[model samples]
Target: MPPPGGTPDNANYDVLVVGGGPVGLLLAYQLKRFGVSVCVLEQHEKEMQDAYGRAIALFPRTLEQLDQLDLIEPMLQLGFACRTSVTYKDGERVVWTFMENIQDTTYDFVLVLRQMYTEQILREKLDAVGARYYHGMKCVDFTYDENLPRANYPIVSTFVDGGSGEQYQLRSKYLVGADGGHSFVRRHAGISFEGDSSDDQWIRIDGIVETDMPLNRSYGAIESKTHGNVLWAPLDHAATRIGYAYTAEIAAKYPGGVTQEVAKQEAIEAMKPFKVNFKEVHWWTLYNIGQRLANSFSVRDRILLCGDAAHTHSSGAAQGLNTGIHDAVNLGWKLALQIRDATKLEVLKTYDTERMTAVQQLIRYDKDISTLMSHKWPSWYEGDRNADPYHVLGEIFEKTASFNTGLGICYSENFVNQTSALSLRVPPGSRPPDLELSTPGTDQKVRFQHITRNIAKFWVAVFTGNINATRTPLRQLRKAYAGMRALPIDAFVSWITISASTGCSPYEALGMEPFGNTYYDATSCAHERFGFSLERGGIAIIRPDGLLATGGPLDGQFVEEYFSKVMQ
Candidate 1:
C-alpha cells in the first residue's frame, strides 16, 4: 500500500536540491551554512552511494575550496596525500611527474580517497549543519510558477520514498538538479545535454592489494603494450586503484565477455613485470568515455543544474569530481546571495556563464588526454604517428599542468570580475595566492585561505601598509567606509585588514582598531605575493568562492564601485 501524501510541517524549504552525491550534498550543505533552508534528496541509499570506481582524486584547488568550507580537515584525515608519481617500463623506473606545477596553496598534493568516504564526510557534516537530508527519497516530479502568491517558495517537488512507498511535496524558491549525468531532473527540466561520445572503453579496479613495484604508494602508470596506459594509484587504507584501457585486444581475449575475473586478470597482465596480489577486491567498473555538457545550466530563473547533471566527461584528467566541486562551490555562494536578495538575480546568470565555459575547457583537455590514453592520436596530432603517446602526453600535460591542477583556471571579465586599477600578479577572476599571515596579539600564523572562509560574503581585504608610514590612508579609509557600512550588500560582505608587522596588539599594528579580522604579513611576502607593496597598501575584493573580484589603492570607493555593478 502507498503511504499517505501530505506536506509535512518541515516540508517547505528555501531550496530543493535533487541528488545526494558529493556535489549535491556540498551545495546543500553550503546553502544551509549560509542560512538558507535546504533539502537534499538522493535516490540511492548510503551503502549504494558508490559501489564501483568513480572519482578518486582531489586536486589542490579543490582541496583549497573544501578547506574554505572547513571540510578539508576531516577529509585530510581519510585521504592519502599524493605528492609523487613514478612511471615504469618493463619494471624499470622511468621519470614521470604530476601536479608539480601547482602553487600558492597549502593543499599542494592530490588527495587519494574513495568517493564513498568523501560522500560520507559530507553527509555527516550536512546533518551536523542541520540541513534536511533524505536517502532513498527521489524527486519524482516538480513544478514551478511565477504566478504563485508565495513567489519566494514557487518550486513544488513531489518525492517518493523508496522504503515506505510514501510520497509528499516540498516547496522551495528554486530547484537545483545535482543528479548525475543520466539525470532525471535534467531531462524533466527540458535541459539538453549536448556533446559527443567515444567508443573507448576503460576499466578501473580498486582493492586492498600488494605490489612489488617501488613507489607503488604514489600515483604511477605502466606503459602497457596491450592495455594502453595503465594507472596505478594508492588510495586511503592500503588500497590501490588499477586502471587501464579495455581495448579491442582485451575484448577479443574475452570472447565470452568480461567479468570480475577478466578485470582482475587483465590488470595483472597490464602490470607486466610488476607483481600484483589482491588481498581483498572492493570495487571495479568498465565504462565508456564521453564528453557532454548541458546546453543550459540555469533555467527559467527558478531552476539550476550542477555537477554531472550540468556536464559530463571522461575521468582521464581526474577532473570529473574536482570540476563538480568547483561547480558546487561557485554556485553555492551565488545561490545564497540570490536567495537572500531576490533582486540579485543577475549573479545567478554568471554561474552558468563561468562554469559552462570552464567545463567546456575541461572537456577539451580531457578529450586530448582521453584519446592519448586510448593509445590513439587525436586528429589534431600533426606529429609523426610513430611518436610515443607518452612523450606527446608529457608535452601536452606540461602545457596544461596549471589548468589540470585547477590553479590556472581563469574566468573572463564579467560583472563579478571587472577591471581593477591595482597591478597584481594575479588577475581578476583568478584566485589570489594563498600565503601565510600572523595573528595580531598571539602572533599565530595562518594561511590566508584559513582566514577567508567562504561565508557567503564578499571579503573586503584592506591592505593597511606598514602602519608606521601608511597610517593616514588607514584612518582615511576608516572614515570613508563608515558611510557605506550599512549598505544593502551588508548581508553579503565581510571585512579583514592586514598590515606588515607581527605587532603584539592589532590596534598598534594599524594605529586603530581593525575593520574585521587583523593579520600581520610579517615579512611582507604576502603583499609581494599578491603584487602589492607593503609600503603602499590597497584593497581587494575576494568573492565568496575565493576568486579575486578586484583590487585598488587603499580606498573603500573601489569596493563600493565593484558591488554597484554586481548588485545593479
Candidate 2:
C-alpha cells in the first residue's frame, strides 16, 4: 500500500536513498535500471568541488561492480590503473606486491581517481536513468509507524531545504541513509556510532607538483617509520597526491600547528630517500583520525544506514568509498523489489544482516592496519639482528593491503541459505567461472557475462548434461520463486547444457575444465581464484553480489526446502 496522500497512480516509492554521494547515486542508478522508482535527498546544494583524497585503491571486486554498471570504460579512461604498489621504511625497501596474480580475476589493477570525479561520473549515471534527487535538502527527522504490520510499515521523513526555509515531508516504504560521517539521518534514527577517535592529525595534499619524481617506475609508493608515514601516488594527468601523517608529539612540536607548509616540508623530508624535489603544490588539508561503527544498520520499521553512515575508520585502508558503494549495490535492488510489490518486506531485514557483517569485518581490518602503520610496532634494533624487521613488516604490509582492497570480504553466513544434496563440482560462496555454454532454449553459445548483470539480483544456475530430465524440476522451481522472490523469473535464471562433444563449455571460458557431473561458466577470473573448487554435477545458488549461496547435488526438493527456511 502507498503512503497516505501519495499520488495513487505513482504514490509509492520503492526506495528513498538519502545523500547524493557516489554510493547513493550508484544505488539509485542500479535500482532504476531494475525499474524501481527511487528518490535521493542530498544536503548539499551541489556536488563537491574539491577531491576527498581518501581512497586510492579500487579492488577487483569494486572494479567488477563498476563493470557491471557499464561505468568501467569511462572510469578507466579517466583514472590511472595501478598494477603494483611498493612500501618502504627508512632507506630499506620493505615489500612490493604486483596485481598480476589477480589480473585474470575481476580487476586487473586498482583504478585511482579523485572522489569528486567518481561522484561526477555516478551523478551522470543517475541522470541517464532519470532518477530524481532533491539537492539542498537535509534530512532532519524520520518516523516509522510500527503499529502497521511489518510488511506495511509507513516511513515518513522531514527535511529542511538549505535553499528554502520551508520544510518538506516525504513518505516511502523504505529509507536508506548513505550520508557520510556525522550523518543526520543516522543520528535521527538514534543509532549509536560506537568507536574511538584518534587524536593524531594527518595532512594530505594533492596538486600539480614541480617535482623531479619518477612516475612510471611503480604504480604507487608508501614510506613509514616510527616518526610518521608518507604516501605519494599519481592522480590525473600531470598531478600527484602526497599524504603525510604525524604523531601527536610531532604535530605539537611543529610550529604553526602542522600547517600545510609544515606537512609539505615533512613530505619532502620523507622523500629524501627517493631523491625527489618538489617545486610546487596543488591542494592540501589536515584532519584527525577517527574510527566508528553504527551499533545497528537498521532501526525500527523505517530507516537503514549504509556507507560511512553505518561505519567509519582510518583512511589507511582506503575502503571508505568502496565499502559504501558496495552497500548501495547490496541494498538498492531489494529496495526496488519491495517498491515494485514483488517481494515481501522481510527481505529488507537481510540487508542489515548482510552489510553489517561486512562492516564489522572491515572495522577489524582497519584496526589491524592502524596498529601496523602506527608507532606500535617494535623498533628494528629491538628485534634479533639476524631477523630483518623490514622483511617481517613487508609480509604484514602485503596482508593488510590485500584486506584494505576488499579482496578479503567473504559472505559465508548471509541470511539467504539453501542446501543441496548433489555435490557441486564447484562449491558455494564462489563465483561460477565463464565458460562456453549453449543456452538450452536457443542453443546459442553464451558466456556468463552474457547472462549475469553486476547489480544485485538472485540467480540460479543449473548445470546438467541431461536437460530433459532437469527441465521439469527447473521450470517448477522457477514458477515458485519467480519475480522478486528470486531474480525476476523473466531475468534471473540461465539454462545451459554442456558436453565434451560441444567443444567449448561455459566453464572453459572461465578457464576451468568441467570436473564434476555439472559445470558452469564464470564471468570474471576473480570468481574462480577466490571461490570455485572443482566438483561437478549439482545446482548452485548465487546471491545478488555473485557470491555462492549454496550448492549440492541437483535436487529440487532440497533446494525448495532450503528456500523455505530462508524466505521466512
Candidate 3:
C-alpha cells in the first residue's frame, strides 16, 4: 500500500514511535494528550500471546501514574492487587512478608498482571486518544542527517508493512526505538548496546495447579537447586507463573534440559515441599538472560532509544516493563512540547541525557538483585539456622525493594536546576501531586486531572503573601491566561492568597498540611509530627511529568517571562 500519493512532500508525523508495546503505547497516549500528532509502528500483528507471561509487577509509582492518567481504576479491575510479597531461599521462607509501607503516599501497592494484558490495556487507551498504529510493520533501516545542526531534520526511517507488501518512508522530528532487544531501529541509528549476555537459559511456565497450600499469590525466591534456581509467583486462581534459571554448563549436560517438561517437573518438585501440586501446564518458554544498556540513548538528535532497545536485564525483579514504561512517560511530554510549540526542539535532546542515566541506574539495581537472590545455601534445613540467613535475606530484600516508585523520579540535574527555591516549589521532573481547588465563580471543586485534560499548558503557581493584594494580580493573570483557562491552578497555588496568618485549610480532605503555621489545622499539626516543615508563600513550577520544575518567591513578571521564553 503506497501513501496514497506515493509519500506526500510533508506527510511526516510529529513523532514516530517504533513498537506498539506498552511503552510505545504510553508514549503515543501522552503525546496525544498534549495534542501532538503521533504514530506507532509495531512488528507484531497483535498483542503478544499468553505464553509470554512476563512482567508481573507494576510498582506503586507506575500505579500512581496510571491513576493520574485515569487508567488506574481500569487496570486494577483487570489485574490483581499485590499488597505483600514473600521471599524464600533453600526451601525455607526468609522474608514471608514484604509489605509496602507508604500509607501517606499516593500508591501503596504493586499490581500484578501479564505483559500481554498490560499491552492490550495500553493499546485500548491509545486507540481512544486517536493515535494511529501500524501493526506487523517492521522498521528495517534508519538514517540521520549528521550534516544538519544537532536538533534539525535529524532522522528518517524505512519500514515494510508485513500485512501488505508496501514500503513506507517517514521523517520525524523525534524517533523513539521501543522495539525489543534485537532492536533494528537502535542498530540502524548506530547506537551500541554495551553489556553481557549470560549463557544461562531460563524457562518460564504458566499454568493451573491444584494444591492444598495457599495458591494465587506473589512470591520471589532463590531455591530449587536440584533442578535450577527458580523464581515463582501466581498469575490467578488456577494458574501460577514460575521461572527456572539454569547455568549453561548444566543445560549442556542434558540435551533436553531446557524443555518445558523438564522445567515443569522441576517446578513441581520445588512446590512439593509447600504441599503444592501441578495438574497441568498451559504455557511455557525458554528465555535467555542478558544485561545490557545502549551506550547512548540518542545519536545526532532525532533518533532515540528506550525500553529493551536501551537496556535488558535478568527477569529477577520484573524491572524490564517498569523501566520501559518510565522511559515512555519521560520522553512523551518532551516530544509533545516540541510538537505543540510549548518548548523548543532543544528540549528534546535532554531526553537522552535524562533517560540514559535512569536506565543505567536500573541496570545497576537489577545486577544487585540478581546476585542477592541467586545466592545458594547448603541445604533447605540451613534456612532454619539461627535466623541469620533470614536476616541477611531481609536486608537484601529491603535494599532491592527500596527502588523509588516511578513517582519519586526527579529531573533535578539535567536541563533544570534543583537548588533554586522556585525549582523546589515545582519539581522539574517529579510527578505532580493531585490537588483540589474550587472554581472561581461556579463554587465547584476542581481537580488537577480534570483541568489538565483539555489544556496542556505549563502552570505557574502564583503564591502571593496577602490574599487581598494578590486578588487583582490573580484576576489579571487569569485574563492574560484566559486562552488557557481550561487548565486549573492547583489548590496550593490558589490558597496562597489566604494570609499565612489565618491558619485556614483550603482542602481538608486531601490532608494537605498548610505551607506553614498560618494555614495549620489538626491534620497539618499531625503532619508536623513527621518532622518536616511546610512553609508557605512559595511558587512551584511543575513539569508535565507532574514533578516540580522549579519553585521560588512569587514574581508575576518572572513567571510571565519564563512562560514566554519556553512557550515560544
Candidate 4:
C-alpha cells in the first residue's frame, strides 16, 4: 500500500496532488521534471483505470503545449484528424464544413482520441519522469498550518490506503485538488462551487455500427424534433460516438429510466432518414448538463484547486478535459517556482487570477452552446418556434471560433505580463507564434517552441538587426543571465540570439560557448511573423510556459525589472 515499505508518520513532500486523473498526473510530471518532490494520491484502484467517458477532441493550442513536452508525436499517431463539421436540421443539411478557416496552426485540425488513451500516454510520460503515482489511496482529510515553523511544508494530509485500509499522514508545502467534479478536497477545504444545473439530459454511446446514412469520419450534428440534437464523431478502435438529447416526449417514454434497449431504439429513431444497426457497444453514458465554478481557487495561499475541482461545465463544446489540461500546465511552473524558493509566494496568486478568468469565460460559452444543442429556447425568447436552431447555433459557433479553438484564450495583464516593448501584433499575455529557425551548430531546422521545452528557464530571445551590432546586446544578456539569483546559472535563465543576415554565422561571430545555441533567420519569416524588425532587432522574454512575459528593447534594466517582479 505504501510502496512496499512501512508507512512513515508525517511523510514529507513538496506538493501533494490529490487526484490521479490526467490533470493531477500532468501536474506531478511537470513538478518532478524540475526536481520538485511531488506525489499523487488517487482513490481509484488499478483495475478501474480507463477513459472514463470524458473528453475526446484536442484543440490546436492543447497540441502545441504537448509538443513543448515532446509528447505530441505519439498522440498524433494514435488519433485521427477531424477537420470538418456538418450540421443538419430535420434531416436536411443546413451548415457544412466548419473548421476550414483554422489553417494557420501546426495542428489546424482537431485530433479525435479517447480520454483513456490520452491518460495512458500521460502515464508513460509520468513514469519516464520518475514521479510517484499511488493508486487506491484515499485522502480522508487535511490540516493547514500557516503559523507553524518552516512553513515550506505547512499542509498535513491524512489518507487511508484503499487496498489495506491503513491510515497515515503526509506533510507537504502545498496541496492541489485535481479531483473531478465531485472533489473531496474542494469540500474539505470549504470552497463553494457556484453554478446552476439544467434539466437537459443526454446519452452518448461509442460503438461499431451499420447505417444507411452517410456517417463521414468528420464531426457531424443533426437537429431532430423527437430526439432533440445529435452529435456524431469518429473515435479510435473502429468505434464512433453517437450522442443525442432527450426531448420531452423521449423522456416520457422512459419514465421507468433508460436502458440499453431504450437507448439503442432512441438512437435509431433519432436518425430518422436512415436505417441503423449496432454491432457492438463499447461504452454508453447518460449525463445531465450543468455549469459550476469554485468561488475561490485557493484557500489562504496553501491549498490550491485545479481542473474539475475548480470549474465544471457540460461537454458540448468538448472543453471540459481541454480546459483541465490548460489549468494543469498553467499552474505547474508557478508551483515549481514557489517550491524551489525561486519566486515570491504572491506569484502563486496569478494562477487563480489567470485560470479563473479563463474558466469563467468558458462557463458562459458552454452554457450557450449546451442550451442550443438541447433544442431549448431561452426563457426570454419571443421569436418564431418554427425557425431552425441550426442557423443561430452556427452563427454563435463562428463568432467564438478563436476561443473554441483554444488559441484565442489569453490572460489579462498581470505582474508577470509587465509591459510591451515591441509593437507587435501579438500582445503581451498571448502565446508567441511558432516560427521555424535553424541551429547554427548543427544547421538543423526546428520550431521556436522546440528549444522552450524546459520549465526551469526563461528564454531570452534577442533579435539582432545586423551581425556587427549583435555584440553589445549579447553581452548585456550574458551579464543579466549571470546576475540572475532566481535559481542558478543557465538553470534559471537562458539566452538565444537571432540574426537577420544570412551571410553571418552566429557560431563564427558570437562565441557559441556563452550562448547555448544561436539561430539564423535566412528568409526573414521569423522577423515578419513575430513583428521583429530586420533593421532594428527586438527583445522578448518568453516565460517557462511559452507565453510572452515582456517584450522590449534589449536593455539590462528592462530584464532586471521583469525578474524583480518574479524573484523577490
| CA RMSD of each candidate after superposition | 2.9, 6.3, 6.4, 2.8
lDDT of 1 by residue, 1-568 (tens): 1112223344678888899889999999999999999988888876765575578999988988898888998889989999988888878887776755457789889999889889888888888888877778878898888788544588888888888888878899989999999998899989898998998999999998887888888788898768888889899988899999999877988889879889998998889898898888898899899999999998886799989999999877788899999999999988887877732677778899999899998888888889898888988988799978877877777888888889889898787887789778778999888888988667777988878886577888988777777788778888868866877667677898877765668886666878888888888887887887877888888988888988888876776777777874
Task: Give the candidates in order of lDDT, highest first.
Answer: 1, 4, 2, 3
* TM-score of candidate 2 on Cα atoms, chains taken together: 0.81
| Tens digit of per-residue lDDT, candidate 4, span 258-292 | 88778888888887776778998777888899999
Q: Per-prediction TM-score, please?
A: 0.95, 0.81, 0.79, 0.92
Best by TM-score: 1
| Cα lDDT of model 3 by residue, 1-568, tens digit | 1111122233577788998778888888888877777788887766344346667778876775666576777678777776766655554665455554544344567777877777777777887887777677888887767676434545678888776767888777678889889888888877888998655566778877765444236555545544454566766433677776555545665685567677777666655465555687777877666689888887766677878888899876677888887787767767776665556656677788777777777777665555444443323333454433335545655565545455455554455324444324334565555444344324454444334322244445444334443444444444544433333332112222222223224434222332221222222222232121235344555555555555555444545554444454
Better of 1 and 4 by TM-score: 1
- What ranges in model 4 sit over 4 Å off? 1-10, 49-51, 90-92, 150-152, 380-385, 441-444, 467-489, 508-515
Best by lDDT: 1
The 10-residue segment of model 1 with minimum total lDDT is 1-10
Global Cα lDDT for candidate 3: 0.61
Question: Candidate 1 overall Cα lDDT vs. reference?
Answer: 0.84
**Model 2 segments more than 4 A misplaced:** 1-12, 47-52, 89-92, 103-106, 148-153, 210-217, 275-280, 344-346, 378-393, 400-402, 423-427, 430-450, 454-456, 465-500, 503-536, 556-568
lDDT of 3 at 361: 74
- Candidate 3 ranges beyond 4 A from true positions: 1-11, 47-51, 89-92, 145-155, 220-229, 236-238, 248-253, 376-393, 422-457, 462-522, 525-536, 561-565
Error of 2 at 324 (Å): 1.2
lDDT of 4 at 389: 61
Ranking by TM-score: 1, 4, 2, 3
